[model samples]
Target: HEAKINGLSITEVDFSTLSDDEAMLKVMMIDEPEKLSAAIAQLPASLYEQYNILQSAPFFLEFLHTDSHKGIGVKAIAQQFGINADEVICMGDAGNDKQMLEYAGLGVAMANASDDIKAIANHITASHNDDGVALVIEEFVLNK
Candidate 1:
């Protein structure tokens, strides 16, 4: 694979026998995120037509259909459950979670999050290892 040759890790590729119209690839930057970006620029966009590239973390990336994204997924789930976005509290510390965090009514970034992620979050909790999620649960859910 071109990406693998360019220093990325090709984790998996799924192409449905049902129809080649849908396909997806999961890959990792593997400490070479900067290089991966450069390679992407050189590669032809038509290599995978009508696809979406989501970098969930600095090191993790997924290629999916253009119509799909974490933010869209979150919105759909919230709507299905009859919960308004304003009523939800989303917490994250990764690039992939950025859109979802921003779409939520209350976005909480962890203390260990990247500066870019922290900038847009509504609140910042403790680090993941510090039980930051529990802090959210207690403060917003338990109110104790």
Candidate 2:
């Protein structure tokens, strides 16, 4: 429905049913109702019930990630880039990117980023619509 509305192609994958290698590079899309429904159907009965309970709770999304997922994602990115986590620089304006930004050597937040994000960043550049990314690249990466 989203793709149809936006005039984009839509592909779906059920991650829970896929092998690790099969799922590794797949761009997981949770925005599609059909795909989400299919993925949810693959969960164990017990886990499914737990998911339902959590879904009804106020803190559902906040509690979704266990510590292991956090560590694994960071480790995987570091390994794939063949660089120490401290050597990387990251910039973003969302809550979900907080961990990645904190792990980077230079974590930059856009001028329009939330106060919380700015607090965690080493620097704050202009907003995306204002070419903040280019400014940062020119001043820090290119000039240096």
Candidate 3:
């Protein structure tokens, strides 16, 4: 309904009919910034136990699997590829990326990232709009 009011297109699904393999949950894009904050605040407490609530952006509230954090994925991939933890560099700016940032050998936070994120980051790069990730790649990966 919020998507309809905001003139956004989304697939409407009957959640009850979905099996575990068919669906995890729904994603909501709140167009209004103020309403986004309110919606996040009003999220039921029970949802936390079963899901990893992530606000990837100011208006996006992403509810993913509780065990599906980026840190775990990164670690698994590193092990699979025989890479050491100290050889991995991870970059992130959102609260949901906290775990991965901590797990990274060098955690990079964008200049526009929150203070908490910056505090945990090993390095602070430019904002995403200014090609922060690309810069990190150039400096770290390409050694340029």
Candidate 4:
């Protein structure tokens, strides 16, 4: 409904029901992503439940629960595994990864990542295809 009202298309959803007990999930992978982005940016502040908008992909817009962000999930997992926030190494190259990168002990942005991500990341690595992950592991793990 939010997508519809915002003139965006909800291409795929894994929701079985809209009950509050179940996590309400929605994604808008529009054919016209530029339009969706523009509309979302200009969305009027409403009294509806606040949502965590993630531009996970250039053409994908995922709307998750207000408190459901990657950083929170990463922190929870790190805690469960008895890891400190600074002991976690997170590498990402997209908007959805912003929080995770910021929260990680070693935040690495891909060479292809956006300026926003690079600005917040602790370090920058090669592009994915160039084996950026391998480079980090080699330098931080094998070399160390």
Cα displacement (Å) at residue 25, model 2 = 16
lDDT of 2 by residue, 1-144 (tens): 434656978766565877755523213233444555465557667753432111211111222423323334775788897978777778777555566678888888888776777899999999989999999899888984
- Model 3 root-mean-square deviation: 4.6
The list of candidate 1 runs beyond 4 A from truth reads 1-22, 25-31, 37-51
Better of 2 and 3 by lDDT: 3
For 1-144, candidate 4 gives per-residue lDDT tens digits of: 456667976555445645657645554445467877786777666612677776776776677777777899999999999999988999999888988998999999999998789999999999999999999999877884
Model 2 score (lDDT):
0.61
Cα lDDT tens digits, model 3, 45-69, are 9988978887766767777878778
- The lDDT values for all models are 0.76, 0.61, 0.83, 0.80
Colliding pairs, model 2: none
Model 2 stretches with alpha carbons more than 4 Å out: 1-63, 67-75
lDDT of residue 18 for candidate 4: 52
Can you list the residue pairs that collide in candidate 4?
Answer: none
Pairs of residues clashing in candidate 3? none
